[model samples]
Target: MRDLTVAVFRPDDERLEDAVELIDSLGATAVPDPMLAVEPTGSPPRTDADCVVLTSKTGAELVADAGWEPGEATVCAIGPRTADALREVGYDVDTVPEEYTSSGLVATLEGAVDGARVEVARSDHGSPVLLDGLEAAGAYVHETVLYRLVRPAGSGDSTERAAAGTLDAACFTSSLTVEHWLEAADERGNRDEALEGLTEATVGVIGEPTRETAADAGIDVDLVASEATFDALACETVEAAAPTYHE
Candidate 1:
């Protein structure tokens, strides 16, 4: 099979190194073009809650930066990555759902949060599924917007390359990545072309929510990770593109 060019849109950090390793493992060229830039909005509130829910690594980083004490609170993360982030900051994660979506977390935390105080820390653009579900389950939910998602300045290049079908596949970890990429494509005056190009190259999403988000935005997703993790997404992308390269 021919070597493939896989565009990675993760942040420029250790996570990006992980993505590059995965791409190299698949014998693909890693395109290190970060699409979204995360900035902490402000210090998160220190709450004396019974449990704390972190949905993303960024949220975990924000909470750690705020020097909030977990105290006796049960720390629940959405997935292994978030759990690892929390653990890196001296908080032991109590629960990580089998599935890694907000709906999945709500399902896993159903009876556990009843009549408990739960704090949710995530991005400003996060969905309210977990918060609403916890509130419905009788938890006093305190929500905090830890970070905001912004498009980096040079992200337009990758969007244009994707639109022009110059890349073999594009891996998207979050719904906001897809949104921002398309928005940048539109701003570059090739929204339609970019959407068409997405159909030509493989589109690998991290999970179901991101797949749905891409579909809603009129992009057909070619691959979805069984687990909502970057490694799984990278594997799925390579598997989805293998047949094309061999043919």
Candidate 2:
């Protein structure tokens, strides 16, 4: 079996459960860290926009729960998972880019959103790429803060494991996860130690923006997953740490 210990920072929920299961399936031990916690703003997206965009599965679910009705509006999602979430909530997704990142959504919608009112509904820590790209393309872009992601209490166990050099790999799904991981380390008075140990481990991020954030924070990222999916990130990080899975 693959013996690598991979650290993953997802909210302690079904997402973390899925990640741990996926790592186990690949034969790699999972070091699950609950990092992001969703605090909904109770603010729904505007329904009168020409197009409505959802960036995460949580955002899609939140908006759907708010009963956001998209009347004569194009529903855009950044990835298949989010699109699937929207569809599951009885919303018709009109556009999903070939690439799952914000940059990809920008590229896919830039040509068509030149004169449209684009509504981007996501978490507080969302990247500026989508909003900026849409605005640059001449769309009147409005951002709706569906939720704010905060670090959960008692969630830095993986940082201690990282500092101890026990982690063979890490899957960072968002920029906030990377930043909050280091913050947790700092609070434990092992920031430098954790960072040093992290350098020895294979690091995988969800997309280019996360890679940039990690690199800027002095964490050498090993690879950016081909897809912006947790399964892709976990598997890629596992492969980077242990090229061949045993047993």
Candidate 3:
């Protein structure tokens, strides 16, 4: 009965540290491998839109730090965290979808955005679902790339562990993290072995898009967390890997 070793791929920020701590508290050994790094693009969302959508907390913080204010525009955040970030920066969050995904925002704003200008501000890797959905719903949409998510250098240790079949489980928070993890594995010539090893491991993902990416990449996902939070993802994965973790 050894502690479950779960690999977590988050950006090298407080989020990564939080993931490690959460896994440790779950009685698991966390292999912290940062697969995503945020590089600010220095572009801010235009304030003239009828409605503004901020996707990630990082996007909200970046735009606010750059002094980009959403004036009179209905402020919409894709998730509660994004909403909190917006509110923390002296902005009003007028809308937050219940689902907290790109499609969720589309559904929440579709009726109101007809013939209105909608500005979507987020990372370059943001799913096209939100933009395409909004466009289909008849909103004149604009996108602002607040930052780019890049794979940090030397981030493939988890891939190596996976290739060796040492990792018991993994928690992936985004589609980009899943893609980056496989990319890192491919770079280390362990893509095939790593992929194979993952078949035996419990793979937990946060969102539908991430699950789709993992499925498309030929990875078997064992669970999709009931919620998109890291705590749910890590706890569910650790429990699946070691059922007695909480007991």
The whole-model lDDT of each prediction reads: 0.85, 0.90, 0.89
In candidate 1, which residue pairs clash? none
Q: In the order shown, what is each candidate's alpha-carbon RMSD? A: 1.6, 1.9, 1.9
Better of 1 and 3 by TM-score: 3
lDDT per residue (tens digit) for residues 21-90 in model 2 = 9999997899998889999999999988999999988998898889889999999999999999899999
Model 2 quality (TM-score): 0.96
Clashes of 1: 0
Residue-level lDDT tens digits of model 3 in 1-247: 5568899998888888988999999878999999999999998899899999898879878987999978889999988888888888888999999887889889998988889999999999989999999999999999999999999999899999889988889999999999899889988999999999899788999988999999999999999998777888888888888863332
**Which pairs of residues collide in candidate 3?**
none
lDDT of 3: 0.89
Q: Point out where model 1 deviates above 4 Å.
A: none
* Predicted model with the maximum lDDT: 2
Give the TM-score ranking, best first: 2, 3, 1
Model 1 per-residue lDDT tens digits across residues 1-247: 4468788989878888888988998888888778888888886855798988888887887788788888888889998889988898878889999988898999999888889999888888787788899899999999888888898886767777777778788899888898888888888998998888878888899877788999999999987888888898888898888777753
How much does candidate 3 score in TM-score? 0.95
Clashing pairs in 2: none
Name the weakest run of 10 consecutive residues (lDDT summed) in model 1.
Answer: 238-247
* Residue 233 Cα positional deviation in candidate 2, in Å, after optimal superposition: 1.0
Error at 229, model 1, angstroms:
0.5
